[model samples]
Target: MKLVAGNMLWTNINKIPNQYNYLNESITCDVLVIGGGISGAIAAYYLTKSGVNTVLVDKNIIGYGSTSGSTSILQYEIDTDLHGLISMIGEKKGVKSFELCKEAVYDIEKIINDLEDDCDFSLTECFYYATKASMVSSLKKEFDARKKHGFHVEFLDKKDAQKRFSFPVEGGIYSKFGAAQIDPYRFTHALIAKAVKNKLKVYENTEITNIYPKEEHVLLETKNHFNIQAKKVIIATGYEGRKYIKEKIVHLLRTFTLVTKPVKNFNGWFHQCIIRDNNDPYTYLRITGDKRIIIGGEDEKVGGINSKMSNLSNDDLVSNKKYELLLNRLKSYFPEIKDIAPEYQFSGLFGVTKDGLPYIGEYKDFPNCYFSLGYGANGILYSILGGQLLRDSILGKDRPELELFRFNR
Candidate 1:
């Protein structure tokens, strides 16, 4: 479980035009968004589309934060198992929360289609397979819960699953709906582009240093000593919001991924479906359009950083060793592919909440401030839903989903 700390997939997408200069003068907007990752960008996009004057600022280059590190498997299936969720939050709330995630996947597809974003978006079925005999009962229980909650799922035997997908598995649960894969960078860039085209102000490389709530508005201070005043402020700064949330439950964990050179025999090994193992340090595999196999997993908590020597530079042997292990695992699972050497290896960190659900909605103490954090693996979908929810709340409209994702709930 060596953790890597870079994003290879997002680094290849088109870059958005950046405004590197820091905010030097005070400005006013209907809404101010912090963090330029997928969540912030989508929030600005939705707010602007609603004709709300919006300003978005990021500490670094837009999409360079946790969004870039995402494996981008846009599925409603969360890091927490359904049975666990039901046990923790009662069946009614648990089922409702799961429905929100299910809706998020469909909502994202509609957004991409309606906007006609050229983000390499594709419809794909996501599969969760059991890698050990001990996991079979849990998998079945999850599958049954999904079915009871009205999700489209099918349980498959090892032979049937192996016949359809080349990956090694003991058994699996396939959900035909509520899943997709997209180039996250392209998606973020597209949203920012559209938001800019609609006259939303996006300031990249403009880091916010502090935020203070005013009588009727929120005041944001930046590293360069610039101030911004907005009626509503949204913090989508990912794990960096630890200071504001003041909760250690938002733990940071790193995950590694490797993309191999395009293989002609990819069809024999994969069928464009997203695959994940039902294990702790679970492995997820997907085939890109160019037939490159993208294998991701090997996650470790941030405290485990020393175990893998990830602190070493990119060309150092420590880095090579991490990638080597990932490649070896890929070969072990899909032995039919030759030349399994990876073309690229990268890693990134994400924040996880104690309850394993993203923190969304407004801060109880500060009415004008909204927070979106702790989207462990489903950041893309949550960002979309969060953006819409934040916008609705800011405009004084009712959003029923807010109850489940609120920060102080």
Candidate 2:
């Protein structure tokens, strides 16, 4: 699949800051991570740091896949609301999932600090507001649920929200902790660089076409006919990893994003906090370190498992109309930021599970293999959490929390 193809904001700014040689001959390792995006990079970081001989390969340039098109808004909040998740999986496990995500944000912070390159990572508050009055009550319930679980959150009314945002908010939940932003393209490269220094082998332009799982080990074949033997494998291919699983567990949703030119002043964007609404097919807004405005939303479902998704939409008319709608939404939100327009707009495919958590453990049939599919809006955060679990699992230690995100769950 053509994972991404567009004038991506992050990749465009970085200009392919890093590169690695592709696989040419057969190799062997303790672990093989397929996909060189943020998830693969994170998993490689953990394994290499722990002294595991690991190899990572990607079909395209590292981080140029969906990671380049990522909005990179890290939040403890899942795409599913706490109340809804509780109904789906019960309170204890549901709350645990949210808490894991919360800790993942700090874990990511620590990783960046250790690397000495934060990748434009910043801790910020997240404002999940309701656009219409009908959403206010559910918003309140969400606030109460979060507060009851000891999260740092505040209930905001219309008047209170209006005070912080340029446009009026019906009501919302203000998350005071565990939300952040980062440049994913740079972050992915940073992790791979650090991992290479720690002795991880990486290859690009290498596509794995076949998997042969044996009783003792697994053999993988690249498109070039090279063979790789490993004790274990990590399928961190993001949305594209769906091809490996037989059962349907996720829906592929296409999302659009628009990034505007730097504005003179942020005007009413309150501390440059992340802004997301409670509407169906919700929209999110964040400001980059360079002060460019990013507004992402407008989700649509793929027609089938084989449906093609490119970073640039094939239909110019549809893509233009979508981009126009996103720009107009931003203008409406902050009319004070005059003469602002998006210089970058792109589309990418991401997966969403029913319970709003990522798949992060061994699948039933994929013996000697684990998947780190960090789908949904919390992709980066989930990747951080998944990486740690994968490392532990590979090291012969199992985490009970992993059951919460089991493929059959």
My TM-score estimates for the predictions, one after another, are 0.92, 0.97
lDDT of 1 by residue, 296-395 (tens): 8776566644644335345656556767888988888777777676777787665677667888886656667888774677777778878888888888
Q: List lDDT for all candidates, in order.
A: 0.77, 0.89
**With candidate 2 superimposed using the best TM-score fit, by how many Å does residue 204's alpha carbon deviate from the native?**
0.7
Predicted structure 1, TM vs. truth:
0.92
Clashes of each: 1, 1
What is candidate 2's lDDT per residue for 168-211, written digit by digit as tens? 78998998898999999889999999999999999999999999
In model 1, the runs with Cα more than 4 Å from the true position are 1-7, 13-22, 267-270, 304-318
**Model 2: how far is 113 from its true place, Å?**
1.2
Runs of candidate 2 exceeding 4 Å displacement: 305-315
Best by lDDT: 2
Q: How many backbone clashes does candidate 1 have?
A: 1
- Among these predictions, the greatest TM-score belongs to 2
